[model samples]
Target: MLLEAHSLSFSYGNTPALSDLTVSLPNGATGLLGPNGAGKTTFVRIIMGLLRIPKGKLRVHGREVATESKALKAVIGLVPEGEILVPDITAVQYTAYAGRISGLSSTEAMDRAHMVLHYVGLGGDRYRKIDGYSKGMRQRLKLAQALVHDPKLLILDEPTDGMDPKARDEMLDLLKELGNDHGKDLLLCTHLLDDVRRVCRRVLVLSQGRKMGLVDIEMQGKDTDLYAVTMRGPIPPFIDFLESHGFKVDVDTDGEGQIALSRGAADQFIQHAVSQSVQIRRLVPLRESLEEVFTRLVSKDT
Candidate 1:
């Protein structure tokens, strides 16, 4: 398991932040999803060892969080939502500083800083002061600093926040490469569902400081029985036939000559369509979008 929390709970004075949360997250890329005040930041802070474990057991990579936080921090990197840069320093200097904080020797830190800055596409501008960089460049620089230590897992908070569309796509592509090709585990915390859909295989949703759902993004809306079908020629009779036979059919509302049906009745549906001289143009299984899944989970929690 990448992370395991058993009966985890936390509070800020009289108010609760996390409420008896229990979850096991596997290795690989996973999205952390939640609405405002949902404890997402609190959870990340706890994992980063900034907050003490107030109650229950929490472990990262099989080590107890309460006892092994220092050791765990050595293997975890963070790309926080807020800026961590010093305006007077160059990107290389800041990145090297981060590496040193992660326990690397000065020589190793400087070398790794140069390598990671290049890897994140900041090599050309690495010597320039951070105050002159654009939002996108700053975001990438944060990523460079996080990668300076080569941590096994990266906890990214709104990594693409404030980026334009092109920059957002580039950042997402980098995340995909790191997770798929570079063998890095990631915890991508963000408000954008599309980001999670694009880069993460799994999602853990929270609501009101509680675990709402854990979803397999690829399998969330797949129903073997449900299929989208398009047909040419007259559609009313085919629709009538399927509806009369007790197979629920939903005609496409956009005038696309498409309908949805249960796959169990597909043979009968197709046979009737053939008998009626209707052409089956397309038939494919339907998958739910991450937005739909997120809405459903949050709604249920409320």
Candidate 2:
């Protein structure tokens, strides 16, 4: 296990942030997804040891984070949500400084900084002032700084928040490479469904200060098969008939309906249409996207 949170709870003076959240994360890339004020930031703060664990257990790398925060931080790297760079400093200088802050010696820090800069594709611009760097370049710089110490675990919060489509794709590609080929465990926190779908295998969802669910990104919203059916006459009768026959059905006002069923329900659907004296104009399979899955889950929880 890479992370385990059992009954984790936190709050401000009056409002609750996280409420009885428990999850176990394996070694790989996972996404933390939620809306605003869903306690995603609170969870990250607890993992980074910036906030004290007030209620329950949190373990990273099999070590309890509340008692062994220093050890946990030593093995964890974080790229925070917003810009934390010094305007006057260069990328190489900032990255080396970050390495030293992580307990590397001066020489080792410089060496690793150079190597990670190249690895992040910032080798040529490493010496330029961070104040003038583009947003994408700055995001890469943050990633380079986070990787300079070569920690075992990396946590990124809203890494591609402000990026354009092209830059976002580029950043996601780099993250895929890091998580898949570099043997690093990653936790990406974002609300972007596509980002999570593209980079993570698992997703932990939070809503209204509670754990909505944890789901496999690749396998979610796939079990129930959906078909768009258009009929010549009375769709309500057909829908009610299908429901009575154990198939879930919904319809629009235009005599078009969506039928959801298990593997062997299609034969029953055809039988129902024929017996009900309805004409089936067209039937097409509708693939559910990840966005729909996220929306459905969040709406259900909320």
TM-score for all models, in order of appearance: 0.87, 0.82
Q: What is the lDDT of candidate 2?
A: 0.87
Q: What is the lDDT of every predicted structure here?
A: 0.89, 0.87
- The top-ranked prediction according to lDDT is 1
Residue-level lDDT tens digits of model 1 in 10-122: 99998899999999999999999999999999999999889998898899999988888999998999999998887799999999999999999999999999999999999
Deviation in Å, model 1, residue 83 alpha carbon: 1.7
State the weakest 10-residue window (summed lDDT) of model 1.
252-261
Off by over 4 Å in 2: 225-260, 263-287
Please write out the lDDT profile of model 2 over residues 1-302, one tens digit for every residue. Answer: 99999999999978899999889999999999888999999999999888998899999989999989988887888988898898799999999999999999999999999999998889999899889998888888999989999889999998997788988998899899889999889999998878888899998888877888788876765565888888866677767777777787787756687877677777777777888887788877776676776777789975
Q: In model 1, which residue pairs have backbone atoms overlapping below 3 Å?
A: none
Candidate 1 lands at a TM-score of: 0.87
